[model samples]
Target: MKKAILVAIGFILYGAAMWYYLMHGAQADLPVQFRGSAADPTMFMNDRQLKLSYDFSRIKDWIYFLSVPLEWLIYLLVLGFGISKKMRSTVKEVTRFSVIHTALYVLLLSFLSWILTFPLRYYSYTISRDYHISVQPFKGWMKDSLIDFWVGWIFTVLTVLVIYFFIRKSKKKWWLYAWLISIPFTIFMYFIQPVVIDPLYNKFYPLKDQVLKEKILTLAERADIPASNVYEVNMSEKTNSLNAYVNGIGSNLRIVLWDTTLDKLNDKQVLFVMAHEMGHYVMKHLYQNLIGAIILSFFGLFLGSRIYSWAISKWGKRWGIKGLSDIAGLPVLLLIFSLLSFVAGPVENAVSRKAEKDADRYAIEMTKNPDSAVGAFQQLTISGLSEVNPPKLVKFFLYGHPTMLERITFLDSYKHKYEPKELEKAKKQQR
Candidate 1:
């Protein structure tokens, strides 16, 4: 009874703290730059051009309310209290319990999404099928689906074990342990991912067009990046988004260009697109972003350990689950991370804004065709159906990109900044 009262009090205090944080901001009085704004256009060579004055507070509120029931379902799943009536007490049983739950959750989510592909198939059919995105048929989709489920299971199961081990090892400071362990693993993922991991999703075939290949080669030379594999991915099996990316590290690094992008973008546009991804590559945004995540998660994990570790123990049985053993701990971590992540939303946005800014500047330097990049960004935003003008609060909490209008305004400012030098460089190149 006493413990229940304490847990209830803890919830109230956490709510109060979160409320105050949102109302005042973690640091509301800081300047726009320090506060993080996507309003600066020079931030990205091609940034999403969203309008700046629109507000979606009501919509966001509605979404927040909608999250409740779904969260409750997920909460139940994580705690092993939903579908299964059995509970585990031992560490090994807890680990198995966590893995089983994660697997089913992943499979369920994937299966449901795959089942929904009928409507999406027709809706996005033109994206790849019309453009020769892939020659794969329904069989291909099934194979890909199975592969995805297996891969997702591997990833989720491993992650669960890691989280469990960290919680066990750290005992008192599992949050700190989670951060330390995950950082290196996440960083290593940067190197191993594109080479060893991504091929599991789809087959990679070298772009066979000599003209296109030569253009890519020349661009690579000009960009001072090593000439390497340019592979086409089978995005045609589903979806219609044109995309390109640089993946892996060192000699393992390769470029995977979507057939859709190749179909839609001219060599110049493709170059601009590749350069943008290259910016992320050279800037090492992946690892840096992961580092930021780990840091924030550490705070979240610490708070979770302090608060829910006890509640989970006391009330875990009510839900037909074990105590703070790994299985039941899963839901607690999920809830804690979700809640605290949203609580620390501003800080995460700040990090993303910084990384994006760097990537933008890097893209400009790599492509030196700021005009094309700007156009590409506008089209990208349009294709993606992103809002141009989000509410100030929405932008503060959610937007990683400076609103599209802010982007254009910044670019307008930037074009003038580089006019003299770009003209000089163009003349020199002509010589």
Candidate 2:
């Protein structure tokens, strides 16, 4: 217990220090031209917008910092107090069947976790609404929250059953087996998420504007992609933010645009955004990411199994856990996995950032319209209230793409590279 308390304190301090650094660190030195003076009012945000952006960022950063340590502490408390064991016992009294007992315990655990963490979720929703980022109604938010709860409960039950089954069957090799199972499970989820899960939240249909759809399809053809359709989702009903993405794999694959994106961007800018999504598809980033995730999970599960064994050997009796096969050990497993994920976040973000940067470059090269590419990012920043430049550590940990400043600068540099050649050609023609 003393060690748990010490570890929690350490995490709390670490989060606090990060929060402080982000809030107080030297701001990224964006060029004056990109900073958008009040008189010029260029693509960059003005002073007032920057102030609001920073204020929103601070709130979000605080929640992120608080949530990590709070979640870790909650898991620790659950394990240290044998709350999971108690819950498992309660479920066993209600159901004699092992599968049923596992499902009920997981349902109860999921509910309790939701109830405990709901305040943060609610605050996050309210803050987004307050900032004019989320337009979702309170009832709609609650309905979505419930859907998330049940969906999560179902998945957790299935995962727990699998883990415990392997634990009882092959105590030593269970981690390896689980990791192998996860590869197919992950792919299955990826394949189905676009067709099955996403529709539950938002309505989607083929792009309504034929001209724009044709243009996007032409752009895809230029990039040598065999896309048959461009889809648009009714996202304006939920949020004012803008986004576009490529999702799924194989036949379920899709290129989707948020309605807000179509409403805000012109045809050229929209084409640039679509080109960016195509970049992901053309570069096979999805497959790359899936392979990377599988590799990481393999190591994560192996290391977690080892640590879990060491921990059970030390405190299994105190925690009321019999062995690895015991469902009561779920919290211990969760605690270890959570710590591992937190430690791995920076590496994961770095890889994602690199992919995103490559995609951005592809977008410019494919479109041959650096101006529109710049415009697309500018509009995204304005609509999303994105920080043009975040602190380095914050970017390293949190950002999965280049900052707005970095993107715009790159576009500007690309534009300049061609402008000199164009000017020289015009001069020769005039002569």
Best by lDDT: 2
Residue 98 displacement in candidate 1 (angstroms): 10
Residue 160, candidate 1: Cα error in Å is 2.8
Clashing pairs in 2: none
Clashing pairs in 1: 38-402, 49-404, 50-388, 50-404, 51-388, 51-389, 52-389
Candidate 2: lDDT over CA atoms? 0.84
lDDT of 2 by residue, 1-431 (tens): 68877886887688777667767764655667666522122446677776777777767767776777677777777888779899989989997999999998888777877888899889988988988889999999998999898888889888889888998999889999999999999999889999999998889999999999999989888888778999999999999899999989988988899999999999999998988889998999999988998999999999999999999999999989888888888888888998999899989988888898899889888777777888788778878877777777668767888877777778766877665766788899999
Alpha-carbon local distance difference test for all models: 0.60, 0.84
TM per prediction: 0.66, 0.92
lDDT of 1 by residue, 1-431 (tens): 46546654764565455445434443323235422333333343243222211112223322343343345434544344343333233333535565666555445544443454444343343333433333457677667767766776677667767767766666677667766777777778876887788888767899977787777767777667675668888775554456788777667778778876777667766877777677776677765766676776677777877777776667666765554544545555566666776778777787777766666677666666656666665555444434444446657776776666555445444566566788999899999
Error of 2 at 96 (Å): 0.7
Model 2 clash tally, residue pairs: 0
